[model samples]
Target: MKIEHPAPMQWQFSRRAEQLQSSVIREILKVTMRPEITSFAGGLPSPATFPVERMREAFDAVLSRQGSVALQYGPSDGYAPLREWVADHLSTDGVRILPEQVLMTSGSQQALDLLAKVLIDQGSKVLVETPSYLGALQAFSVYEPEFVSVPTDDGGLLPETVAPIAQGARLLYALPNFQNPTGRTLSVERRLALVETCARLGLPLIEDDPYGALSYRGEPLPKMLGMNPHGVIYMGSFSKVLTPGIRLGYVVAPVPLVRKLEQAKQAADLHTSQLTQMVVHEVVKDGFLTQHIPTIRALYADRCQVMLSAMDEFFPKSATWTRPEGGMFIWVTLPKHIDSMKLLEEAIAQHVAFVPGTSFYANVPETNTLRLSFVTVPPERIRDGVEKLGRLIAAKA
Candidate 1:
């Protein structure tokens, strides 16, 4: 009684769609979701630091005061007061941030995507660190840019080597403060040199700094943008200190670039959420971050210390890891013979997990390296996980 039709054929797709690949960390996170596993895989902020009651108060206040406007459509650039707040917060003695130069985004990730849209063309050369943020690599790859990985050390990006590799490059993407996966902060001198060199070379610098505010030490370093405002696009986010749920971040750049980014943003999502922006503004209008950020610093420092001590006691002498002053991760380089990807299989069997270093690179990867996140796991659990991981490595070695 039913009419038969020809079988459906495979849908044709663009070449760009064919090149899209899944994030390795995202795939690893699925296995780590089990309660039994002690996961050091995700770059997630500790939930204990989230100001739940304060955010609730802000939401209620927004609804009570500007309910109609908060729910309606807004400008592609962002809400004015929120943009002004971002500008004021970032301005320093020598550097002045104009509100017109600030563009609010859904998150710092959206800023990366927007920059890629405006700056990258097919086969355009883009410079990056030898090992960089996986999320940035994923976002930039969609644009089909030819990536050139510049060598890095504990001090962060090498300014001297930059000039040689950066020729014919569209931009150099860097996370100078509390860098993801590495947890290293660039020295003030190096930052100044890098900024100066980039300015001279006419290469744009995109500074993605989400974890800069989470420094364990009370002191903060001068931003690279402060050195060369016209040459750099600085990105910041409310995700680390507050909560990622609100999905709030902003980019400060020169007026001309901001105009192009706004156009790209218009096509992306029209605008970031108006309600979220208004609520975040209400929550932090009276300088809430000034008090809130220090507490996060203290908590993370204690957790980091716990993980460091555990590594010292349990791990072998041959295994080396970075001792970060502040930030969420610890990079461990195991013995030359061991591959972290294979080690992860054993670690998961023993109910522990970490991100392999291979996922953070643009091209050839170091299989012996891995990244450990200390903030989310409790002290006792961290001790347990590190000990188990050390024993596995010791056996393999």
Candidate 2:
């Protein structure tokens, strides 16, 4: 028996598994979780804005009324009523979305995965804005596509520059309203031009709008999905407005693509949680978000202003940052010599943390940049964190 021992077997993973890397922001968040840390690293919505009472009531009602159905497995596409609700909610005067076109997922992040799975082949040319959402990049990279970073300015992705590089591209992804890392909203003029350009080139566009509803003013800009319903795939999430814990997000695309995504989703998870879909539908079906979203906007607006003011007062004159009208993030650019990855190490020693901009880029990363999220932190803590970061930058500069 002693001579019959076998050696340990080594597991072989696929090539795609090797390409996957841990999210830098997520890793930083683990360090920031310490109570002493004043973290602006996560794009987490303020817990104060969560509809605790309403969510409680909704969950109770669902359990009391339709407990069996809520607990049972749901359609792969999603709960029927919730799909209808999303379709109706997103429908505009010019663009009418049918219930058939909606596919609810665990979150928009899952939608990104499904889209990549369906649309991307090996070496597929996928287009993304320079410094696009890190989550999107992480999702897309799993499929091993060739990511082409399109140029962007303050207003967001450049439309004119798109077509030239757009040749042979599988799809163009953009966050037209309040982008994640930069918080730069695409202008209406550029939005129109971008849609038209994509249409002319027969390129598909992925419109990810998690923070669109968080606009400081009550008004959100027109969605690209409204411009070219058939050509664009729109992804929206309740994570920013409602609580992220339940994990509900959706996609509105052409019926054909919706079917394909549904098939992919079925293969992945079969469906998003039946209870979560029903509970959220019960909450949002009767115009709850109409009143609720405004509260979030106001709180985030105040916090954003506080952070901006602190940056002005504390940050060095050599530093520059985005002035976001809405959303949780502000992208900061320090002097070119300063690497934000190293700066984050110094910041953690001072009990503060942020996501370095290098993770946000698909191709050439700008190491001098970093993203700050203001919503979760208190105003005083926001100021303290910004001041500490400022002092650090001043020393480096």
Model 1 regions lying over 4 Å from their true place: 1-6
Please, what are the lDDT tens digits per residue for candidate 1 over residues 134-167? 9999999999999999889878889899998887
Candidate 1 has an lDDT of: 0.93
Instruction: List model 2 lDDT by residue over 97-214, tens digit each.
Output: 9999999999899999999999999899999999999999999998889999999998889999998898899999999888989999999999999999999999999999999998
TM of each candidate vs. truth: 0.98, 0.98
Pairs with steric clashes in candidate 1: none
Q: Worst ten-residue run, lDDT, model 1? A: 1-10
lDDT of 1 at 78: 97
